[model samples]
Every structure is written in C-alpha cells, then in structure tokens.
Target: MLSMAWLASALIGAFSLAVHAEQSHPAGKVHLGASERRADVTGLRPIITWPGSRPAQLGQAPSASTTAAPAPPNFNLNELMRSILFPNANVIFNVQIVDPGEKPKGPPPDIAANFSISGWGDNLYPRWDVVSYGAVGLEESAYLLMKPDRLCQNGKPVPVKREDWIKYVAELSATAKAVYTASLARDRDAVAGLADRLNESCATCHQAYRTG
Candidate 1:
C-alpha cells in the first residue's frame, strides 16, 4: 500500500511539472502539434499578435495610437529646378525681354484649341495672373529647395545645411516676393528692373555650387 501511495504522489508531481512547463514557456516557444508545425513550415500560420495576446480582427484598421506617422516627402534638386524654379523664373525674365502686351502674329496654336500643352506666347506671356503664379512658384521653390532629404543630380545630398546655400535661398525668396508684388501692380517696368537682381541671385548660387 505504501509503494502504491508513493507511485501516486510521483505521478501527480510529474503531471504538475508538465503543466507548469507549458504555462511558463517563453513567447514563440509554444509547443506545436504536427499539423501546426506543418502550417508554420509552409508559412500558412499567421504571426501577428495583439496586446494582451488578443487575436486581431479581420479587416480592422489599426488604432491610430499604434500606427506610425508617415514620412516626409523627398525631392531631387534638378527636377525641382527644372519643373518649378526654371519655368517660373522664365516668366519673370520674359517680362524683361518680351513685351507682355504684344499680340500673337498668327492664329492660336493647337495647344489653345485642345489644351494639349502649355505654351509661352499666347498662354503664359502678357498674362498678369500667370506671372503672379510664376513668382509664387519661385517663392515656394525657395522653401522646397531647403527641405530635408533633397538630392542633387550627382546623387549627393543637397548642401542646404551650408550658410551660403541658406543665404542664396533667402535672396531667391525675397526676389520672388518683389517680383510677385510688381506683377500684382501690373508694373512691367518694375518687373523688368528686378530681373537683374533675380539673375544675379541665381547665377551666384550656380557658380558656387552647380558649375564645375
């Protein structure tokens, strides 16, 4: 009878140890059945876990508190110049070279008919609105140029951190604002007069950073 009692106690202790082992198992070390092991091996098992070991709801959006904020956009310096600064600067520069009030000699082009493309002579030139937009674009370009993560054409990061680059961008912004004010007043002479200062601002920056 004593031997039988001893055997019963030993079996109870082993059973308790087994249960404790399962409960105390570290995360991701849970024992799996053959089918579970097969599913894991085949990558058919879901791996995501929720707080307090709760199962995730199907098709449910994650809580905003848990979601990461989106990253800021990055831009290329060359593309920014070609698309924004160069085109807008041309609008200001054209006011100096071409008479904005001059009428087109020929009939309106196909671009005017179907709006297939944007042109300078009839669509952009002589229009105070377009020139104003151009100046606004130039002012905005100053901020864009200073944005972090912008890359140059050579795959190197833009030197926005440099003091000279900051000064150049500030000059561009101030020049753009002056052009915008002149454009608003419809003062062709004022816009024309500021063209030299605008050119000088751009040329100085290019000579320092862009040219070989």
Candidate 2:
C-alpha cells in the first residue's frame, strides 16, 4: 500500500531513534527490556556490576599460594619440653597448693632496683592469667611434640609417629585445655582438681619417652 521511498524513509527513522536511545544512556549500563526495567525500577531485583572478572566463585579451587601453611620450625624436643612445657606445668601445679586470686603480700618490689631478677616487680606465682598461659602452653606443646624432625636429648628422633606417643600428647592437650577453662572461670578448686590429671598425662609421657 505504501510507496518504496516512504517505506525506506520509515525504516531509516526507526534506525535513527534506536541509535539515539542507545547513545542517550551512560556507558557500561546494560540496556534492559521494558519488563526488566519495570522490575528494576520497582526494586524487585538489583543490578550488580564488577569492574573486572568476578571474584573466586563458589566451589572454585584456591590459588597455590593459599593452599598450604608454612612448615613448622625445627626445635629440640627436650628444650621445648623444659622451656615451654615444664615451666608451664609448674604454674598449673602451683595452683593446686596456692590460691591464684590471693594478692601478693607486702609492697610491690621496686622494678628499677630488682630488674635483674627474672620477674622483678611482677607477681612471681599464683596468678590466674599465668595459669591460663601455662595451660595454653601445655595444650600447644602437643603440636610442638609432633613437629617434623624433632630430636630427644639422647640424639634419637622423637617418637611422634608412634601410637602411644600420639595418645600421650592428646591426653596432655585435653587436660591442659580443661585447666585453661577452669582458670578462665577463676575456679581454684576446679583447677586444683585437674592437677592430678595433668600430672598423670605428663608422667605417662615421661615414663614412655624420657627413660633412657
């Protein structure tokens, strides 16, 4: 019904309108259909945009750098036991006989004058915080015991791979965790009661491993 020239002109006008509509919008904006625009405007759905590729998607494998933890440092088993375990165990044991909440007697020592002493002005014993530290040290000692390439005093490798050794370490860690929990509650009797269990855990390990 229409002439060829009129039909061509109508087509050109439609193309120009489409081009203008596209140009009017800001760059990087997705052109939505009428229904999508209505949904977006009504807040039914939000549009999300990222500057680059989307961050690690769910179920994606992690990068190689984040795959494994660094190796533990090599340390002597005997020194670790003496320095970290023995001293901390003593702190736990002391709690059985002494009340951690009790304040130190007399005036605090002059720190400047007695700086040479290891604990100078600080309370040397019976502190709830120290008890917690000791317990934590004992618990963490289990990990140190299992350290790769650890050696005992007599030049033999630590029996970390042995089943009995693993069991003893687990017992020590559990008792130590219990001691720490009691220490946090400031329950002196509770901590005191755990001393025997802690001692037994240590004694069992020592009997099995420390004997020459």
Candidate 3:
C-alpha cells in the first residue's frame, strides 16, 4: 500500500499536469503530437509542449511585459542569529554530557533529565530528531549568513569583505555537521568534542563581529 505522502505527491503531480495541458493548447483539446510525455510510477503522464506554441505555465507565473513588485526582505542577520540559530544550537550542545556507551546511570537530575526522549520508543533512538534539527539549522544558517545582500538590524551590511568572518562561519557549519554526524552514530565522545569545536567557531566569529 502506498503511504499518504506518496499518494499526496501523486495527486499533486497529476493536478499540475492537467492544469498545464488545459492551459497550453485550447479549452478542451491537448496537443501533444510534437510534445514528449513521460510515464512514472504514479501513472501520471507528464506533458511537454512543442516549440513555437504557447509555453506551459509551471511553478512560476507566465509573464509577458509586466514587472512583479519587489518582495520585502523579512530577515536581517541579528534577527536570524537571535531567533533561529541560537536556540537550536543550544539543543545539540546540551546533550554533550550524555555517554551512550556507558551503562545506565541512575535517574538524571531534575534539570538534566531526558523526559519524552527516553530511548523507549519503538525505534529506540533518543532525541535523534532534535539533534538532526540543530545540525540542519546550523548548516543552512551558514549559507544564509553569506547571502550577498543580507543586513544587520541597524542597516549595516554583513561584512562580506572580511575573510575571517567567512572562514569562521564555514568552520561553525562544518563543526555543527560533524557533531550531528556523531550524534546520529550515537558516538558520545565525538559529539561532545565536536560541540566544543562549534563553540570555538561561535566565539571567533563573535570576537570579530560583535560590538561591545
């Protein structure tokens, strides 16, 4: 039996193809004589229109001469750093003390206990999802931080010209990914060490960028 996700994807693809077919040739008829159609597992046939015909509209809107209004920029560096990156990074960092290899210790202290993430689930992985989220956020945020036109909240631009900033951000991303990898492997020492590496990266960048 097909999963709900697969079924949803198939339905969406079919609907998209149907819309394209309707828009391309005419109201009722679809002209695929000069077009190529491909069959997939979903049993939906993709339609490709011929040259010199009206082009099919896909994800983007079909435009002739009108210019679309510019989208307002939503996020600046300070906001993103504070709102998204900081909390997520802390989640992964918090688990640094856990030693997966050691025999089960007695109940953890109230502040340090793993509650719902107790490794008693059917999959038996403890808080793997949370660790993965932090890893992905760190890796992705590095790329976003380097976006050409990103600004700080005070209207100053990110220091793209500073080589050290770039290098440190890259290091942070790499170390976060390494931490994530170790977490997935349940390697306690590796995760602990790499989390420290991530901290070093953060400190170096803050020294260069953060104002007193």
Give the top-scoring candidate (TM-score).
Answer: 2
Encode model 3's per-residue lDDT on 44-131: one tens digit a residue: 5345576987655343455767557556447888898998789878866777765444555696546325423233231232355456
Off by over 4 Å in 3: 1-53, 57-72, 98-125
State every prediction's TM-score relative to the real structure: 0.60, 0.63, 0.58
**Model 3, residue pairs in steric clash:** none
For candidate 1, report its TM-score.
0.60
Candidate 3 global CA lDDT score = 0.67
Off by over 4 Å in 2: 1-73, 121-126
How large is the C-alpha RMSD of every model relative to the true structure?
28.6, 26.0, 14.1
lDDT (Cα) of model 1: 0.77
- lDDT by residue (1-212, candidate 1, tens digit) is 44757755775686677567646753223256478877666734455676787776444588989899656445688888998899889989989877665666787667435542223234532367667778889998887888877789898888889999999999999999998888767788999988888999999999998956
Rank ordering of all candidates by lDDT, starting from the highest? 1, 2, 3
How many clashes (backbone N, Cα, C below 3 Å) per candidate? 0, 0, 0
